[model samples]
Target: MSYGTSFNYETILICLVAEVLNLLTTFIFYQVLKIPLFFDTIFIVAVVFYLGFVPAICVSIGYSLINSFMWICKTGFFDPFIPMYGLCGILIVFSTWLFAKNKSDFRISVSITLLYLFLIALTSSMCSIISGGLIDYFHYKYYEVTDMMNPIKNFSEGFIIQHYPPIVSYILAQIPVSFLDRLIATFTGFGIYRSFDFFMKRR
Candidate 1:
């Protein structure tokens, strides 16, 4: 995949718009409403369904970098670890590409759509587990940062840690959360993709 050729000026502009809208969506859900779920990948998945992997990956990386910068700007805390979560976005891009790409049509059956969402959610859950584990490993092994950003996730991990190993606890804590988040993101992403396709076709 020659991403250099794929990433033209138009692609860059679209990715920038995706990143800005993603940032807005995330801020609305996470900061304004205090929602724990990260719907940040909706636009990235949409880009995957609409454009392709390269453009979607660009949006994903942009989301991570822009969010990291925003976090530092808001809190004055320079945690370079924020961009590590972009692994989850890359995972979403592939999952969407494989299972949901170009499948956004009004003629598609509800059962099949549900199945696609479930499969994407399952894959995304695994991705989040792996990414979170790596981030936590690096954080504990190298950095002195002890602050847990999400108290609910921290509490869930703490509770599960008593019964299972820390790794298992971490995985368990993230599965439901990641699953729900991806489920919503995949559904909304495809819906938006379908809407755009429909509008364009009408035009």
Candidate 2:
């Protein structure tokens, strides 16, 4: 391993842990909370906060692949939002890596952590909305009108669907939930990693 281009073992390990946590949260959301999409970007953001740009990119690539694979296995089709999942990593890597150069800075103060969480929320919100719009576009583009009663078959149910102005309604409906989901995951993931890091240091 060299200085800049070495294999990021630590990043890989943390990303794996994050992936496990994502699975758990997915169960909680769909099985319990009854949400459709998986909402978790905290691990990726936390990784960027610790490891910087390159590792974050790795996380994004790995996370996107894993997420897409899992969804395809479950639903027997490809999800339209794999790119958005990757986008979350790109946003976190660049935003946090450019803003905070060192690991210590991320955990330095409560304010900084909150700020980072807010940024993750904002980024996730934007990506989710854009992805939603893209998905809707593709859905409508290939839509085969079966009957007048239900022209939009297999369309995702949301405020945006069947609305007068779908794009605006969809975005507006997505923001509140997206912000809250990312914010919670950001805080939870950051705290879990930092706490684990603290114990590891003691060991």
Candidate 3:
């Protein structure tokens, strides 16, 4: 199967605006939910996952940039946790696009979800590195400039380092939440599309 190689100007604008809105809703939803997952994941996957490669990439990049900026605004500086949203977005989009494009004729099996869940784990392992093992490396760089503010961060870093290697433990710790979240996101996205189709049929 082939994928579109370019996005039109209109497509780019739509993705930018829509993703911005998604980010706001995500922040609000995350505050209320007890589950440990990014709130926008399902919406992003639902809107663009079946649109194939180009749209998925566009939404992922746009969403990630805005999410990073929001984190900076809230925390008064950049946070490692922010960029992970982009990585997860790409994985979720690409996985769904690949499955949809390839299996255009049939229902996706249970294996597809499980396989992408594994991909989520692999991508998140890299998140530990990107986040500097829960900001351990950046602590010395940014924290000093911030005047060692936020003792909670300092304590968490100490706890992470003292008991287990920060990077390893960080990755292991996130797996369960990320796995469950993405699984539900993928299926919930399917339900959303089904609802849309039903409504259109009624119309």
Candidate 4:
């Protein structure tokens, strides 16, 4: 937590790598698979299971084992942080799934998706802010870096005030992305059909 107490570069590196991998995986799922909007809700939920329950527990334990072998590793374990990240992933997934499952029709689905998307964005931003604040607190306590606390506090306040506008913008952005994904999916079937026709003619 402390800046002066020898920062865990390895842990930060691993987390950044994991985040990049997750982002790429998410993009592939959304763009390449082109899953239907209705089905995306379910897919997102399943992905959360993989990220939270599977990878976090597995990767963290593995990292911890390696770290424990090194005499210089400070924390020497990873179970504590892994469970927190896993729990957050579970909450995000479960909330989206529950909201999606409740809608019974197209109109309801659109309405719920918009509402849930906004809530998710807001909650995600706020949670990040809060976590940053907690990390700052630890940093200040451990390293006597009072300046770090101020920035975190400012970020938390700003997020609380401005979270809704960004959330709304993100929901609006998703409207087009969802439509495009489905359109691509439809076109993929057409392309396959045309290819089959061409092959038959050649034969």
Leading candidate by lDDT: 1
lDDT of 2 by residue, 1-203 (tens): 21122456765676677667665766676557766444556666566555556766776677778877876787677756544446645654565455445555666788986786677557655665565455545544564323221212233345445663654544455455556665675666567657776887899
Q: Tens digit of lDDT per residue, candidate 4, span 1-203? A: 11111226643444445444444544456446643221112223322222223333333343334333431354443333323333333433343333333324314566654555455445433433344334443433444332221223333334446654533333333333334432332233223323544675799
- Worst ten in a row by lDDT for model 2: 145-154
Model 1 — which ten-residue stretch has the worst lDDT? 143-152
lDDT of 1 by residue, 82-144 (tens): 788788788878867776544554247888777777787778778876776656555544555
List runs of model 3 lying over 4 Å from the truth: 4-21, 79-81, 103-162, 198-203
Q: Which regions of candidate 2 fall more than 4 Å away from where they truly are?
A: 1-5, 8-10, 35-37, 79-85, 100-109, 131-163
Worst 10 residues of 4 by lDDT: 38-47
Order of candidate numbers by TM-score, starting with the best:
1, 2, 3, 4
TM-scores, in order shown?
Answer: 0.83, 0.68, 0.64, 0.31
Q: lDDT by residue for model 3 over 133-160, one digit each (tens)?
A: 3454344444442312221334345547
Question: Between the candidate structures 1 and 2, which one is better when assessed by lDDT?
Answer: 1
In model 3, how large is the Cα lDDT of residue 128? 26
Q: What TM-score does model 1 achieve against the real structure?
A: 0.83
**Candidate 1 segments exceeding 4 Å error:** 1-10, 102-108, 140-148, 160-163
Clashing pairs in 2: none
